[model samples]
Target: MSQIIGNLSQIGGDYDALFCDLWGCLHNGKQPYPAAVSALQQFRRAGGRVCLMTNAPRPNQYVIAQLDRMGVPRDAWDLVVSSGDAAQDAMFAGAVGRKVWHIGTEKDDGFFTDIPGEWANAPAISRVSLEEAEGIVATGPFDEANEAPEDYRARLMMARERGLVLLCANPDVVVDMGETRIYCAGALAEFYEELGGQSLYFGKPHPPVYDRARRLMDLGDEARILAVGDGIRTDVKGAQQEGIDCLFVTGGLAAEAFGPDVEDPDEELLREWLATQQMAPRYSIGRLR
Candidate 1:
């Protein structure tokens, strides 16, 4: 069983650096959680370095701008690392000079620009149909609110028939927006794989993003870094694989699974869920604060 923690302060002394997830832990897509923002600010004030590691399918700069708009103070974190950065890096390294169909929202278009030549040859990215594409870069479903993995069945089938490779930018199966949980790019990627299509994932529960996070944090000791997030599949599993202590937040994405007062989750249910995953966090909290 994971120990329940009241706030980050209670376990502040245990870690020198914090690798915190951005989406559910700090905000719910619409706005920032005041308590969570303040907690990270406080953690930073106490000589702790915070890296806003996220699975957002956009570059770190884009995420920083979004954070600013959401009123998440710049002082709250020391650095930012995102799956978009990892995806870009991977694309630069592996997909250079290749053409790919961008399967995502209009808001996700920024992911294709400003490629640095120092890394790898910039590849040509298009929003054209499957017939014109050599591969696919799936950021997420274009219509998250009204769509599901099944909504992409036809398109994925077409891409699969074309023998296209898929690069999944945000490897999150679902995310909570207020009280609504919507399917993400990971779900589509999973479905595509189930259809015998080859897919590459770039986010939590994957080593590339974690390696990027570690490098961005520049923290020498992995053991001294504490990972904080809500997703059991991504955050908890990622931290465990990275050999870092993780603090799970229950009131974020998995709120419904734990029952009422999600901040103070039902221990038995939470434990059962963890048991199924064969993973556990060092500590659990209702929220990041």
Candidate 2:
């Protein structure tokens, strides 16, 4: 474990660019954390460059628009990179003369619209259709309240029958959609894998997402970059895998994971949890704000 540092001011002097995480550290899926926003603004004003990185499945433009609505100004960070952006990059890389059956909301169609590919909507296609399709992209239409595991199972079975490769845009199983937890593309992908389907994931908790962020920031191997987020599985694990420092915000995924009784887990308890996981953030705080 790396030596944990408590001061935010120390971060400003040590790192060249910050690869910050969204969803948990910056906001709680409803509103932006005032303290966190102020800290980032202060960091930028003090000559630090911050690159906001998120696991949001939507394209960069959409993510930025959402953040803007959430009161997080675009100028808070030097750059923004999302899982959607990386998925789009991967699609473009292998999409020459290929047709894709995109299973996602209409908003996500924007990610593939201008790209060099054809789109199709088939819950299940025949082997002939599989021969026609180069790949299958699942973005998430599965709402836990409306769609069940059977629905995803049936769809994956159909895709497998046709021998189509699967690409999961959002690797998150669920996200805080206001007060409710809604299913993401990852949930469907996981079920598909259980049924003997091949799936590729692109997002945080996965190394590729951080790798792309590093490149975007022009960060070298030894560059000190802090990954601040709420979820231990995604933000914390992702930073640890990349060998970068991290700051875990308490009010996100681990809120209840820490315990329902304790609304605010102190720094010592947080440190104990990190020690148990073999992961330690350079710092830990109650909320991003």
Number of the predicted model whose TM-score against the real structure is largest: 1
| Tens digit of per-residue lDDT, candidate 2, span 1-30 | 343334456556777777787776777678
User: lDDT scores for all predictions?
Assistant: 0.85, 0.71
Candidate 1 TM-score, C-alpha based: 0.94
Q: For model 1, how does the per-residue alpha-carbon lDDT over 113-207 read when each residue is reduced to its tens digit? A: 75756654444544556778778888999898898888778888888898899999999999887778888899989999998898998899899
lDDT of 1 at 184: 84
Candidate 2, residue 242: CA error in Å? Answer: 0.8
lDDT over C-alpha atoms for residue 104 of model 1: 85
Candidate 1's displacement at residue 78, Å, is 0.6
- The parts of candidate 1 lying over 4 Å away from their true place are 117-123
